[model samples]
Target: MTTEKCDITPNTIVGDLLRDYPELEDKLIEIAPVFNKLKNPVLRKTVAKVATLKQAAQIAGMPVAVLINKLREAVNMEQIQIEQDSEGKTIKPGWVDKGKIVIEYDASLDIENGLHPAAKVTKEITNLKEGEIYLLITPFLPAPLIKIVEEKGYKTYSEKLNENTWNTYIGKQ
Candidate 1:
C-alpha cells in the first residue's frame, strides 16, 4: 500500500506517509518540532495511523496546505493548492462555557499506558444532556476521537494548554 508521490495530499495519514516514505519522517519533524512524537513506536503505530496530514498540520499550528505542499516538494511532486479547513476552536463556542461542563475526564494516563480513550470518552459524551459540555483532557490532540464525536452530532472545541496538554470540550448540538 505504497502511496504515490502525486497522492501526497492533506488527507494522507501520517502513518501511511511514513510507511510509504520513511525518509520523510525526519523531514516531517524538521517541518514541525511537534512531530518528534513520531519517534515513539507506540504513537507511530497508534496516533499516526488515524491522524491525517491536515490534522497533523493543525496540531503543529501551521497551514495544512503549506504542510502538504512542502511534503509534495520533498518527494519531487508538483505543489498544489487546497483550501484549509475552518479555524475551529480559535474562539470558544457559546456552549463550551465552563459552568456548563458537567463531566471532565483526563485521558493522559490511558494514553501513556498505550490505551485508546475513544470508548471511555464516547460513553461519557453519550450521556451528556443538552446544554451540557464534556471536557476531555489528553496529552495530544485527540483528532480521531473528536471526529467520532462530531459525526455523532456533537459540537466540539479544543484548546492546547501546553506542549502536552489539550482540552477538548464536547456538547450536544
Candidate 2:
C-alpha cells in the first residue's frame, strides 16, 4: 500500500500521526528505537496524545528537523526546514568532565524494586560544588525531574544513548 505524503510538523501529536499514517510508526521506531514506548498502553493513553515531534526529538536526543525530515521521507512528503529552538541548552554536553560527579540512577530498576531515586538524585545535585556537574543516567528522559531541576535554576543537556538509556547533564550555574 502506498503511504501518501502527510504534513508532519514538529508540533504534530504522535497519536494523530500514528492514526493517520500507521506505517510511520515503524519508521519512527527505526529513527529512534526508544519510540517503542509507543507500544505501552499507559503511555499511549497519556503521552502519545500530547507528545509532539519536537518533544520526541528531545527525548531521542536528535535534532527536531532531522526527526521531522525522517518521518516526512517515510510518508513521501517533501522535506521541510526547521530552525533550532533556543529554549534548550546544548543537546551535546561536551562540557561534561570525567572529574564531575555522576548520579547513575536507573529509574527503571527503581520501579522494578519499588524504590524512588528522584530524592537521592536531587540531593546529589544540591550538593554539587560550584564547578561540578551532575551526570544523571536514567532509563528514560526523566522529564519531570528535568523540569523540577531546571525550575530550581540548573541548566541541563540531555542525550539519549539507545532504546532504554539516557544521560542528562545538570550544571548548577
Candidate 3:
C-alpha cells in the first residue's frame, strides 16, 4: 500500500497561532518602516499614530513588545509626546478624555456618496472646529480621509480602530 502524506499546512487562525507559538504572536504584530516607504504618494502620506503598542504591532506586522519598546524610544527622543492629565498626572498614552468632540457617521451615507464613512466623518468634524482639539472615532481610515481632515483645518495626533471602527485625534495646529 502506498503511504499517503498527511496535510500539515498550519491553520492560520489568530487564536490557533497565538496558542501554538506565544512568542511569535507578539512578533507578528510589528510593522516595518518599509510600509512607510511605499512608493504610492497616498500610502506615503497616510500616517497614523497607534493608540496602543498592540495596535502599532498589528499595523506594523511585528511583535507587540517590540512595538512597545519602539514607541517608548520615540517618546524618549521627543519624536512623540507622552500625554498627561490636566493635573500633571501621567495618564496612559492611549487614553482620550471624555466629551472631546467626536465625529460619528452612517456607513450607508458613505456607500451612497462614494465616500468612506471615516472620511465623511473627518470632513464634518473639521468643519465644526477650525482650530481646536477634537478626538476622531472611526474604524480604518485611508489617505482620502486624512486629506479631508487636513483640509477641514485640523491636525491629527493618531489613528486608531475601536470595535470595528476607525478613529483619530485632531487639534488645531
Clashes of 1: 0
Q: Is candidate 1 or candidate 3 better by TM-score?
A: 1
TM-score for all models, in order of appearance: 0.64, 0.55, 0.37
Compared with the true structure, all predictions reach lDDT values of 0.84, 0.75, 0.43
Candidate 2's residue-wise lDDT over 1-173, tens digit each?
97663369977878878888888888899999989989889887767776667768878777888899888887778898786557432335556665775554556777558775668778778877776888877776666676568778887777777878777788876
List clashing residue pairs in candidate 1: none
Greater-TM-score candidate between 1 and 2: 1
Q: Score residue 58 of candidate 1 by CA lDDT.
A: 69
**Whose lDDT is greatest here?**
1
Better of 2 and 3 by lDDT: 2
Model 3 lowest lDDT segment of ten: 5-14
lDDT by residue (56-83, candidate 3, tens digit) is: 3444544444444443443342233334
Model 2 segments more than 4 A misplaced: 1-41, 44-55, 58-62, 68-91, 102-108
